[model samples]
Target: MKDGNLDSIDKRILYYLQQDARRTSSSDIAERLDLSASTVRTRLNKLENSGIVRGYHLDIDYDLAGYPLYTKIICTAPVPDRDSLASQAQEIHGVTAVREIMTGERNVYVNAIGTDHDDLNRISKDLDALGLEIVDEQLIRDEYVCPYHGFIDEGDDPAPDDVDEVETE
Candidate 1:
């Protein structure tokens, strides 16, 4: 389904799933939203079937897991080859994620985690071998994630005030 097809209930289901998909059960969400467990499950199934839910993922702390080095490798690839290059980048060892950016000279971004300098260096070389010119390499300290509160309707309970509203002309 399209973005417009996602109603308030569907969005709230997504919001709660983002919070903690592993621990957040349908019963738990039902209690909060006053929705029935079966209804939540049905909605969740619809979301997954429509490919909106995709898959739940673990938030890993590479530093705590003994891979202390996290890095982002910025690269440029020919516009025509960006998509294929990004898919290939994921096959490289230590490369955790690859993003293909549209409308930019530096079009591909790769995030990698490694045990040390040598491991990161190897990842960089592998990416370069795949025809992605290494524009820059950054030592990443930390990453943060939060659910998109825009999913919830304004008529519902107040959203968290932590997010700053951006005004656009």
Candidate 2:
């Protein structure tokens, strides 16, 4: 809470919200943390106002929703056209996410979902039309990593026990 830093209580609130923001109420958080409901509400409001808490979002199960094919496309565009290409990609029907990578052979990374292989192919073709040279395309077989618990721990630095020392070469 000091200068945009999240203290222990704020981190706990974030942890509970991250698990299920829509369902977790301020009262529930207050009861669990042994704090008053109004206190929790005030703190949550502060968090929101400070931009530490962005808007909550739903994690859709695209596969269950009938869009089974999830893919990541790595591509590059001309320096001047990067923004335009990204804007166009975002407008594509199935593109869920688009990111501009600052480093690497490929400058843009796109995440898209489709009903099947043919649908995915069409999405790729649409991207190709934007003048981006596709360097690689990979189907996301599984998402083993996630940032749902990213704010669980307090402090910027890692715990002493979490780090290991290496001998100098």
Candidate 3:
């Protein structure tokens, strides 16, 4: 998948797997699609090894765990040390994901998880201290999150002290 060598069958396998990670495998998919089990298995293994299918997790109801808020924050750091600046933003609470998005006008974006708008801003200040010329920022106040598509589940929260390195692809 990383080499962009996936065919139509590979994409179909991924679509079905993403739909329901709990009830998918080479044999089951092969039975439905009329493809050989070996083919499905090999394609799946290739996707896994190449990091396209990064990992799997059971979709948990986050409300039951007291994490009720869902929000996103985009940050722009027109600084040279983009990684280091992104690192500083990653130190704040609720800053679950941070990355230097681009090198031009909008250089950084942060996806944060918090219960309130104040919390997002509280985290933004720590990011602002990196000495970057920020062009602008947009806060996604409300939206529907596709649980099946993101990198992490609702329960496997990243701690405030954790450092995250975002990959641009």
Q: What TM-score fits each model? A: 0.90, 0.76, 0.63
Which stretches of model 2 miss by more than 4 angstroms? 1-4, 79-81, 144-150, 154-169
Model 3 ranges off by over 4 Å: 57-64, 130-169
- Estimate, for each residue in 51-140, the C-alpha lDDT of model 2 and write its tens digit: 888798767778888888999999998878888898899999999989988776699999999998988889889999988899999998
Question: Which has the better lDDT: candidate 1, or candidate 2?
Answer: 1
Mind sharing the TM-score for model 2?
A: 0.76
- Which 10-residue window of candidate 1 scores lowest in summed lDDT? 160-169
Q: What lDDT score is found at residue 85 in candidate 1?
A: 95
Q: Candidate 1, residues 27-124: lDDT per residue as tens digits?
A: 98787789899999999998999899889998888898999999999999999889999999999999888999987788999999999899999999
| Candidate 2: worst-modelled 10 consecutive residues by lDDT | 160-169
Per-candidate total of colliding backbone pairs? 0, 0, 0
lDDT of each: 0.86, 0.79, 0.62
Instruction: Indicate whether candidate 2 or candidate 3 has the larger lDDT.
Output: 2
